[model samples]
Target: MALIEYRFDNLRHDRIGSRGIDLQSLDRRSMEQAIAELRALASQKDITFPRLPEAPVEPIIARAAADRKDFSDLLVIGIGGSSLGARALLSSCTPGNPGCRVHVLENVDAHEFERIWSGLDPERTCVNVISKSGGTVETMANFLTVRQRLLDRFGVQGVRDRVRVTTDPESGILRAFAQEEGLVTLDVPPGVGGRFSVLSAVGLYPLAMAGLDVEALLAGAAAARDAALAPEAESNPAICFAAHQVALHDAGTRGLVFMPYATRLFDTALWFVQLWAESLGKVRRHADGHTENVGPTPIAALGANDQHSQLQLFMEGPADKCVLLLDVEERRDLRVPAVPAVLAGLQHLEGQSLDDIRAAELRGVRAALTEAGRPNATLSLKDTGARSMGALLMFLQCATGLAGSLLGVSSYDQPGVELAKRFAHGLLGHSDHAHLRAAADRAGQGKALTSVH
Candidate 1:
């Protein structure tokens, strides 16, 4: 199994000066307690993600293989947690010659959806509709639109052969539709929510269809799960990371910049943004009936690229942010040719591989941030393989859960998101959500408005 290396030296005051975190002053007891709580949570039957790696994958693999044999393209329809995890996996693992072209219909934008839909050959396309609740508007809208197109082109039997659905096994409108249509289906596991469903059929099915190694991916996640369960906080990378983040948050750090050096892992950073923001950002109600808004803002950035774009603000902006740098030690490489004599000033880069320059840039940024007294840390992978990506994703998920515990928030629920969804449903004229629509209209009645032409 490939393991990720967690380095926190740059986050320490001794290394990054006064503005950095001081290990001696950290709340060790609170962190330990949080980890203990997370351990218990993991052992609970209702928290199913930690056990996802152990679920049987034979059925998923068989289905994917069949899809690969029959289809030239696979369209994954879903949004947010439903689509982000699969995007992260495919972006990072399905490079080179993918077995089938995988396109994702994650948004409800008509133009984007039309582009993807129009490009696909209906006869050779497989549609995978994924929604744990079977009720997400964006996901359902896109899937319904595509289903209509498939029905027009292939008829009912053809639609059944081409469509696959992953939803709640025991309930959900999508499940009922699948049964009514006799479409092949997979379960999203009883307790595994969308954000935590990657290791389950949600991710494995698509990955298998792409001819990637699902077993290796699960192995890496399992390894990460074991490491996160270590008895000592220092021995568990996830706990240690969560503890540092909590300490930083206590010190008024509000923004977390998740910058990954590799372009492929940029999607992984976005996936982390959702996991961290949705899982941690919450209104915590105390025993006294008072509520406080909690959780840090997660900023996703691509390194080397963001170094040119957002690095300036980070270096000199408010001391309200901490940087988490992601490094992939090995990558596909290209050597820079020797600089021409006329361009002698740029000779320093001559004969250096692109990866070498990227390493230098990462190191220089770390040093510069340290000199500026801005706290930062790095999480590194030996290579951008399936195992490494799995470990990276699991580590972030574990850290998010632990950090939520430390912050005294419910990690599994997103009440704020649901409130927004209710408003959207109301706006769309859903009878049950009419009250939410009225509330939204009332709130918007006298708000100032601005327009630009």
Candidate 2:
């Protein structure tokens, strides 16, 4: 059986007619063009993550095994794309190791910094600092601080044993340090951007080190890539999905709701929020240099839980949102024994399991949203296992790439984020950015008073 499935049946486009996107019309208009764009991206050797699952990962696997034997705690340092995908996979698929806990420091904020360190015994923990260019400020800052602690406790040998660097193959500062210090290292692959690097060493090495089935995850992602690459517009889920959603965006749908029924899949939605927001939210276009505010806002919600919270506003507030629901089928279903009901009218739920209630609620919400004229779709996962999670991640990633193609935007580059990085680097005393430092100093003078209230 296929490990995952994608369907638009709940979209009710036939009944909604013009309000919901007509896929046939979308196919007639832009299917070939979108496929070509996606194919062009796939052909680029620099962007190899689409095929990363099938690539050699033995080096990552071997090092992970070695690290597993040596350390009782693991810490990963990075920000944004560098850490989100890895964090999501670790939380979703890996059971907590009673002996070794994993911590990902994606923030340098004081509270976040203290919280991560407070839980760890510095002597036994291993730190994997990841950044593609080896120049990311937050990552390097965390690495330097943690590196001194490891050196103080275990000396230079401990620093070499406990620290691993994942970065560019030959050129980056991290790679240079690894060569000089005899530290184990993994390449982040040449063209893979941070947001698109989950399948690369950025994610796989940490997963392997934590004793998860990374091979199975990659196999699942490979299967999804093959499915997404299918040439036919109607048959290829990724292309078809992008066409539909982009059409909705054209029709003024500004918000995207990702509501998952399973607790384990919550991080998956959070990961997508970054992927979609950073990839598609853009100012420039490949078509005639068109510049206008564009892109869909991704909103995350959990089923049964968020139904009581965000659904009210989502259903009744505006006509400008679309909802994607994730329904997970568990491999092992627990049954509830017949028991006395707590309330007089609630006897009907006495013997039904919690999963059954969640499933029923999914159906109810879908029906309600459909009747309210809200455009909605559902992604059903076979199980909450690694393969299923892997397939889901790949499906959305391909869809993001395809959507960028349709919009004529460069999905891989994040220009807005880079400007902020430059400003922060200047403020942090980069010699090449004196002007930036002066402007930041000016900007900070009046900003402090804003915080007083």
Candidate 3:
């Protein structure tokens, strides 16, 4: 059986009426061509992310074990791809585990820094500064602030002992600084971008410190990778999913709502948002030199809870969304108490397992969406274990790469985000970006049509 069970029945014309995808009418040749491109890319040395699951775990395990022996807490300093993958992995796998605790500082909020800093013992906390380029303003700011705190608490040598750096192996500011300071360092792999570096030292190191089975995580990812490389598109989940998404997007589905019913998997959905939005959303220049803006807007949502919060809009407000519902076959659950005489409306929930009730909610929502002529699909997992989470992450990443191919855009680059960063640097008075800063100021001088005080 597949690690994830993908059901597209509700996304079919027969199930969801006029708005659903017609399987027979899908452009199979284009999808097959995209899959072929993905296959070719996977074999290239420049694209290393697809091969990350097969990387050796011994070094990461050894380093993590050593760090865990000395530190009681880990303060991670990074943002975006540098931190999201680790955060998702730790959140999903290490909850309630009696292991070294992890505290991540991804934002520049002073209050958040203070809260995390005040809770740690500098002596027992190890600071991990991650940046593939080592030039991220937010990450550098947090790293500097935290580094000073460690220096204040402990001497220079002590700071060296407690701090680590993860960035490009040979270049970048962080790499140079680590070499000069003699601090422990790990590489983020040469060709792997930040978003796709999770299965590398970027994510594995922290997960290992958190007492998660990093090997098992890779094992699950490897299984998914093999399935992704299958020649038959029908048996390949990633290709099939990419084809479905491309077909739906072409059919006027502008929003992709990723709703996973499990709370542990919520961050996974958020991770998917960045992966999908950044990778596929692009302005592409065709062979004729004509450019066009493309890609779907990805919305991250939690289930059962969002049923009350966002379901109303998804059900009745918009006809431009295609929902991907994630359901986990939970291994542990609780049963509701017997019905009470005073509460009659709630009687049906009594004596039912919480998951059983959740299953009903999932089913009801799927039915309601279908009845209303909305397209949706379910990706069910066996459980939310380390293996399952690993498989899910890899599967989504592969699907995203294939989707980028279908859209005729480069999946790994984020030129829009880079442009914004440049503007921010200019606005912040960076010597190199002074021209940009002046332009930004000029743009800001324009008056608003209306305002309220």
Q: Residue by residue across 1-453, what tens digits does model 2's lDDT show?
A: 467666676455675555577665675447767777666667777657687887788988888887788788889999888888878887778543333467899877878888999999887788999988888888899889988888888999989888988999878888888899899888888878888899999988878777778888888898888888777888888887787788899888888899998887888889999999999998754457657767889999999899999999888998888899888776445666665656677677776878998899998998888888788888888876678778889889999988887776777888878877888989888887757987777876764454455
Clash count (model 3, backbone only): 0
Candidate 1 residue-wise lDDT, 1-453, digit = tens: 247999899888888776778888767788788778767867887547877778889999889887898999999998888889989989988543357888999878999988988899999999999998788999999888888988898899988999999999889888888898899999898888788888888888877888888888888888898888787877889988998887888788998999988888899989998999999999888899999898999999988999889999999989888999988888556989979889868998888899988988899898898889898999889887788778888888888888988889978888888888889999999999987877888887875988899
User: Residue by residue across 389-444, what tens digits does model 3's lDDT show?
Assistant: 88989998889988988888999898988777888998898888878987787877
List ranges where model 3 is wrong by over 4 Å.
Answer: 94-98, 449-453
**Would you give me the overall lDDT of model 1?**
0.86
Q: Report how far residue 93 has shifted in candidate 1, in Å.
A: 1.5
Best by TM-score: 3
Supply candidate 2's per-residue lDDT for 65.
80
Model 3 residue 450 distance off true place after TM-score fit, in angstroms: 6.1
Per lDDT, the best of the predicted structures is 3
10 residues in a row with least lDDT, candidate 3: 91-100
Query: Which residue ranges in model 2 land beyond 4 Å of their true spot?
Result: 27-29, 45-47, 94-100, 286-289, 335-342, 441-453
